[model samples]
Target chain A: MELLKPELGLIIWTTIILLSLIFILTKFAWKPILKGLNDREKTIAEALNTAEKTKLEMAAMKSQHEALLNEARQERSLILKEAKDMKDAIIGEARDKAKSEGAKMIEEAKREIDNQKMAAIIEVKNAAGNLVLEVSEKILRRELNSKDEQVKYINTLIEQSKLN
Target chain B: MCEYLCATKKRVIALKVLKFKLFITIFLLSVFSVSLVSAAHGEEETNSTAPTEHNESKKEDGKFNAKKVILEHISDSHEWHFFSYPTGDGYKDVALPLPCILYNDVNGFSFFLFNKLHHGAIDGYSLNAEHHIGRSDGEGFYDLSITKNVFAMMISSILLIWLFRSAAKGYGARPNQAPTGLQNLMEVLVSFVRDEAAKPFLGKKTDKYLPYLLTVFFFIWINNMLGLLPGGANVTGNIAVTTTLALFTFILILTGSRKHYWMHILNPPGIPFGVKLILVPVEILGIITKPFALLIRLFANMTAGHLIVLSFLSMIFIFGQMSPIAGGGISIFSIAFSTFIYLLEMLVCALQAYIFTMLSSVFISEAIAGGHDHDEHAAEDLP
Candidate 1:
């Protein structure tokens, strides 16, 4: 019973002290402390969120860059393929044109050679006929010196003509 | 892998066997020493008790009273008792006297140092067996002196203020920077009280009640820790201190309660009309019991811890009267157990403070919560 009793003065003092303590501490200690904690939390959360956003942006940019690089590679390969096909077509056209030109040039040269050979053969034939006529006239003039020899030559010429 | 597992298993078995052997050896040694000491103690007890028996027959001055000694040590006093030893004629008490303040209707006011009353009565007021002040003519007075408990409370309160003030000042100096030293430690405790204790229960109103919860938590925790030190007063163990704290909580709960809260207590929902007759009284009793339990729980837990440690220490003196060898042997075990309990009390110091504040916040929140239906409507009605 004695131990359970309360002292009035102590209670009064304690109440006074505790009330003042609550007021003073609430004003001085808890406000700034809670504010600081909240502020720091907000800052850290903002930092992390910004970092996450930047990382996502970087990933998107990286994928876009990869896509652009692939397009460039495709364009480069397409240009290369077209250039290769053009090169092959141009070479084929040039080779065909040179072959046709060379064949036409050879046909003209063969025609020119044939015309020259025909002209030479005709000239040679005319020269041979004139020479034969001159030789025959000379013989006839020598042989007509004697009538008998002439009669015998005429008869032999008639008989040779009959045999011909 | 199999081979390795088998080798490890064999090694483990060997280690376990060696540990068991060592344990048995220690157990046997302690048992043998205890029995030998008890045997020596029995002969000395008879020799010592004979003189005390003679002294009791002649006079009661020489006999030892353990209850008186223990109660005196645990109870509040007007002086701080450090230690006492035997002098040539009698035992001398080494203590520092505190101031005593008294006010009476007849005597007006009286103030003096406590040492003046050591010999006998002074100014019609004297200290009784329990160290309480009383008049020689059986009169009463208002005591407002600086007793050991009050002194200790003042010291701990001053310490708490200084600690938090410095921590708060540091926060003020560097508002957005990281905490260092004392600020860092205090921030942990403050945040713990807020997040773990206050925020879970109080919710949006946490800011409003946080100051009180923090104060109670730190006040109780600091005083509990201080009480564990040697020659320190048991402030929290005192009924008066706990009662005051309980009253504060009672006031808060009552004042903060809404109309719906009382309605629930008076006429509980979903209960039959006939049951209300029995339930209403029980509900009201429940309200009173809540704070009563708080008062008893803190006071009993703190007091029991102190009593148990003192009992362990008292064993050494009790055995020393029988024989010095028995006392020495028992001292080792008693002091070891006391040290272990002392460490456990340190953990209880923080745990009990947390429990007190946590429960207070829960009660306050429940009172202010009103009715769920009303709250839902209030939310819906908001623009």
Candidate 2:
């Protein structure tokens, strides 16, 4: 028989070799290799997903922190405003009370001074009246019942009242 | 009256003889005509003549010779250097020559190693030298000779895997850490492969095949790129190389196939009984055809580019044989054209490699997705 063409021989051998290799690879190499590959892939993917998760978590934490910071700032401002308002209110109340108390004490002191002055004036008027009455009685007893003397005493009394 | 009748008959006979002489004159005149014979011969020769000089010359030179040309073509493949480097001691090119010298020897298991050791004695015309793996050119017992391209492919693959693994190891638990050097580059490749190639088709299963897919992608791409280099061994261009790689894919797809995968191929779901008969066979055939297409696409694309380049180079030699001036012009143009094609081939090599890996990953995804739904689907189709 004529020898096969080299191309043909090559083909036959290639088929046999490749087929057998395929079989062996399928049986032994393929599964383990692919499994290892798959396992590696899974691990890598898990790593990536973890990275993604971490990134998201970081973002969330950042926002939460910002919110907390903002709330604290607002609370601080509110406390400052309230403190200032309380101080103003206390100062306003104290000023209003001091003005009213000062005005009331001054009015009461003036009333007491007015009552003593009125009592002193009344006593002086009484003493002056009694002294005038006694002086008139003594003068009338000593001077006799003369009409001219009575008229003169009445004139003196009128003149003294005018001077007082 | 009888004598007068005899005189008239003699005259009539003399006239008849003169008429015969006129007929002979016309016949001789026709035989001597030059234009008529010449025109007649011209039309006849147009229909029946053989031995056209142009065709005969071509036949003598033997055009369209598939057998002889194929051998010459195959032999030309042997001339390709598997690797390249700059010419000198202690240079990077030094390592390149090792693979080339090793690839040229008689192929065997230890073929590459032995050639590297015995490069001093080897030369042209010694195409069939004694190989170290106990096989000579004539023996043909073992053709397991690892070509330089194969070795290069293996080396490049190992490097790529190592780079990626090292990159992954670099990621610290701290969030603020930056990846260094090769790690950064590897991160880009890993992300691109995952996001662009595998993730779209494989979806959730994208992670399952990422490493294998990445390895295949780089392996094929690097080898294909090497093939495009001048004097480089076209490992991917070899049908055996493509076929072996394709076989691996085939096995992966087959083994990873979920039950639903088989059902879709053997008995599709949600089809009427009558329709199922037609669709089932087509689906089954499609399963086989997908991988077949992968094989042919890679083989044909790789081989065709090489064939075109070789054909262009052959033109220069053919023209040179005819005339030096003609050869010079043709060679210049051919070189330009070959350069353009080589650049295009570089892109194609990477594309084909990526396509192969992508398809393999898709197949795996489909297989894993098949699951229990396929059984129910197949059962529903049953009469």
DockQ of each: 0.35, 0.01
lDDT of 1 by residue, B103-154 (tens): 8888878898897886678779986644557798887788878888878887
Clashing pairs in 1: none
TM-score of chain B of each: 0.82, 0.61
Clash statistics: count for each candidate: 0, 3
User: How well does each candidate reproduce the native contacts, as fnat?
Assistant: 0.51, 0.00
Worst 10 residues of 2 chain B by lDDT: B85-94
**Which runs in model 1 stand beyond 4 Å of their true positions?**
A67-164, B1-60, B119-123, B129-131, B173-178, B374-383
Error of 1 at B285 (Å): 1.1
Over A1-164, each residue of candidate 1 has an lDDT whose tens digit, in order, gives 55567777667666766777777777777777788888878888998999999999999999999999999999999999999999999999999999999999999998988888888888777655554454445446665868888777667655654565
lDDT of 2 by residue, B182-245 (tens): 6567656656777778888776566456656765676677767766766555556556666656
- Worst lDDT run of 10 residues, candidate 1 chain B, spans B52-61
**Considering only N, C-alpha and C atoms within 3 Å, which residue pairs clash in candidate 2?**
B85-B93, B86-B93, B108-B145
